[model samples]
Target: MNEELNARLLELLARIEPLLPPEQAPIDWSRDVAAIWQRHALGGRLTAVAPRDGVRVEELVGIDHQKQALLDNTRAFLRGRPANHALLWGARGTGKSSLIRALLNDLGDEGLRLIQVDRHDLVGLPTLVQSLRGSDYRFVVYCDDLSFEGSDDAYKALKSVLDGTLTGPPDNVLLYATSNRRHLLPERMADNSDTRIEGGEIHHGDAVEEKISLSDRFGLWLSFYPFDQSTYLAACRHWVAHLGGRFDTDAEAAARRFALERGVRSGRAAWQFAISWVGRQ
Candidate 1:
């Protein structure tokens, strides 16, 4: 009877073993320059990905001041000098995310690597950082479209990774995040109701303080704004020419009409127009 029960247990164990998640394969950092953080029941892993192509730093227009500032900081970081984690915040489709991607394409040959992490997957940031601590390549852990609702707690993990914990982020790694929200958190009217003046100084409520603290952790803050008429047309011309389209007088009029229909002129809108105009020709 004991041997019969043992046989049944062995059969069950064999079936369960095949259903378990496999151990993650080690990334070849020497060859791959990018990855995405993927979380699972058994912790998390970095899945290697091919770097995106066709975005060059020179092609980005109208945000030259922001482009140069981030470039200087990144150059300093690659040279092993003191640099701060950067936060790029502002209007949607305003080239905030493009600048980061362009930075990677510009400096990739200089040992700069990128690892993209979703805002929801930030809870595993410490683990991800730990894994990259020993790597020789400098990593930019990018989080795109990062914003949090009032009830979300994942920001706590990101806060700890940024500056809260004693371990802190390693020297070989820096974080670059882009968000449409300047504060990265939703603000409620009630949150401002508790403000008061004391000693001739205004004090923010605890709720406001909590929201500001996260953005404050980033030492470098870059702001992006909506493009004006001349800037928007310039961007359209650049992309249209790059995409093998002629940006003549008629094309300029069409681009303006396109922007009017969309109700906002941005780098993304310009690119979309370029594609449409070029494809139609």
Candidate 2:
């Protein structure tokens, strides 16, 4: 009777085992250059992934100042020098995310590895950073399209990882995030209703301070703007030429029409136009 009860318990355990999150596969830091942070019911784990290919830094056009600033900071970090966490904030479809990918491609040979984490999974950031401590390879903890709604509690986790912690992030790890919102939090007119002046000095209310504090932790801030017509056209021409398509007068006219129809010009738009234009030829 005891043996039969044990057998029944074993059978029930087997039935439920497969529903649990799979064990995280061990990552070979020396072999893999990129990974993604995956959250699960148990906690979170890093999954090795292939780094994106064919995105050269040279191919990124129309944001020279932003590119150079980030590159310099990254280079400093790679050399074990002081470097600040970077926040790339600006217009949609600009080269914010592309620059990070390109940096990985350009510097991966020099012991740079990328670990991408989603904003939703950021609650695990401190644990993740602690695990990567004392590693030989430098890590870029990348969060793409990061932003928080007013009610989101996830930003607290991020803030803790950035500066609120006692020990702070490891020397080998730095966070690089991209967002369309400069502050990474939604702002409303009501939030500013508490603003007041005293002793000829202006003071912000608790709500305003809360929003600004998150972005302030990132020491390096780079802003990207919408590309002008000339810059947009130049990018279109560059991509077309790179893709083995001729950007002649006719192609230029067509590109202009494409941009006009879209109502916004950006590096992404230019790349799309190039793909469509080159595919026909």
Highest TM-score among the candidates is held by which one?
Answer: 2
lDDT per residue as tens, model 1, 203-278: 6476678888999999999999999999999999999999988999999999999999999999999999999999
Off by over 4 Å in 2: 1-12, 195-204
- Pairs clashing in candidate 2? none
Q: Could you give candidate 2's per-residue lDDT for residues 1-281 as a string of tens digits? A: 99999999999999989978787668998899999997766778899999777687877999999989998999999999999999999999999999999998899999999999999999888889999999999999999999998889999999999999999999999999999999999987766666565334355476678889999999999999999999999999999999999999988999999999999999999999999999988
List per-prediction Cα lDDT, in the order shown: 0.90, 0.92
Per-model TM against the reference: 0.91, 0.92
